[model samples]
Target: MTTRTRTTTVTWSQANARRLDRQSLGGSGSPALGVTEAVAAMLGAHAQVLSAAELAVGVRAPGVTRAEVRSALWTDRSLVKTFGPRGTVHLLPAAELPMWTGALSAVPGEAARLPGDARMTPEQVEAVVTAVAEALTGAELTVDELSDEVIARTGPWAGDPVMPAFQGMWPRWRQALHLAGHRGVLRYAPNRGRKATYTNPGTVPLPGPQATHALVRRYLHAYGPATPAHFARWLGAPRGWAGQLFEGLAAAGAIEEVTFEGVGAAWVAAGDTAFPRSGPRGVRLLPYFDAFAIASMPRDRLFPGAAGDRALAGGQAGNFPVLLVDGTVAGVWHQRRSGKRIAVTVEPLAALGGGRVRELERRVARLGEVLEGTAELTVGAVTVGGHA
Candidate 1:
């Protein structure tokens, strides 16, 4: 006779509180994690907007300053800026580059939906990536300089200006830029004046066969109990592929399925099933593209009622700065800086009690401290647009 595996059930509130604790966003008096440690804890900080990334780290690490975050990236070489989850810019821990590269490289590539003439064949892509690695070794080059070097090394086909970008066309070879980053061949360098530069990060060891499995486990630890579909969306990978990968892990006894109340079946890292008795009990001001807002699953629960309409942009998370009360989105906020002062506007969906209002005031003050500016709070509508 075969015995069925027992499944544990968790409520959304309990799950959110557990995740908040895991993410180090529980409340005041949390451990003062270093910049690199904070970034690693969050998997990575979304850095398409560099200031937002700095604030994301600052809020999690209590007294960390923006200068320290930059120092870690440029001075100490503890963090590296590169394409991470969803193929977006992120600040990842330098030591974990091998695991990230390995897992990202293993993600099935989506067919480019570009015009036929603009697309590169597989062989051409390989050549372009190889040329990019060779061009960026031991030196930093701006996009224009790198393009010139790559075109010279790989021939004219690479330089074809057919791929449309913004107001103009980009070279065909540029299509492989993110792929090179994922392969650990290229990374961001300090800007020269106003121009961005790239460089080779030197030799990165190939990830072991279990690298992808390790990544899945890490994701579960941070944002479980989650479904394979949720992991696929977070990674920008194919849903079916993620499902198969999760099935393989389950077979290996690396993960266990559990039932989430109000949600269906989900998986967590093996033996990682415990949760807090209650949900979070504080206020937080999260910046644009904050990892917690983006990676947490069952979005409807995190952004409930009117929050689903206000916080998300076209059903996509992290487009707007969010106000978190009790681990769920309670409002939207916008910050404007003028000299050393920052003006913050918050639009809460409902009225707050006296204590929560006081907590909100303190949270805004902390935001100013993290930004190295004096911040004043105004409880009103946030008129600024998404990512403004």
Candidate 2:
């Protein structure tokens, strides 16, 4: 007789509710204490746009300030800003760099050819990565300063144009920068003026195979009951590779397959269960590249109908600050600063009850305090997603 496999069925509402709870967006869990804890809890906070990353933590940590996040990155040395999943800049706990780098290395690098048919030879790529790591080991240097160091370390060849793009000439070292970060050797230092700088992620043991597995488990812990494709998209890894990893984990009994209502099959970490059915969540203002806003797949469910059309551009999520009503994207919002006041404007796709609107105002006021300004909210018309 064959032993039959059992698959748990989860409802769409249940899955999303659990996700919101895990993401710390529904007030179900204790708030993280500071940037380091906040970034660790989310596995990593998206940091491609530095300000957006700060806001993402502020919303989840409650009472966290931009200065606190900055201190964590530069002063406290508790968090490190580095190229992470999808080759995107993310803020990760300093000590966990090894695990992140190990996992990120599993993703293949971008194509070697640049726009002008200028190709980076494998040796040049390796040399550039090494030079960047050495150049940033303990010092914080701006882009131009680092470029000078790279040229000194690896000769002018490292500074050749790898591509001709709007950002001017994309250099060979620029291509290797993300790769160096993924290798756990470099991170972004806090801005000292108007210029961006780079630094080492502090000393940590280089990770091994176990680190990659740990990274996968961490991803599922924060955003699981998700498909392989979802994990692949999140990591910028190929779907086939993600699927293989998921299958291996399943075979090892590290995770179990589950099916969601109106959605297909997904994997959840072993012994994990959905949250109990509960009342709806409150309104929230999430900034651009907020991790919660982009954590799951079949984003249509999160951004339904008109919300999808309005909140996503070219299938890209996280370009705009989102208004979440009851755990789903209901609108898009923008903010501008004038003197000591932050003027917030919301454009709802559907009616937000008077009570919720007031609550949203409270949240905005809290955000204003974090921004060190008084927040003034103005309800307005619905608009498409993207920075205003």
* lDDT per residue as tens, model 1, 162-264: 8889879998898899989999999999999999899999747456447789999999998999999999999999999899999999999999999998778
TM per candidate comes to 0.97, 0.93
Error at 54, model 1, angstroms: 0.5
Error of 2 at 258 (Å): 1.0
- Model 1 lDDT-worst window of ten: 202-211
Query: Poorest 10 consecutive residues of model 2 by lDDT?
Result: 201-210
Positional deviation of residue 128's Cα in model 2 after best superposition, in angstroms: 0.9
The sequence of per-residue lDDT tens digits that candidate 2 reaches over residues 68-128 is: 9888887887888888887788998988887888778657665554654466678987888
What's model 1's overall lDDT?
0.90
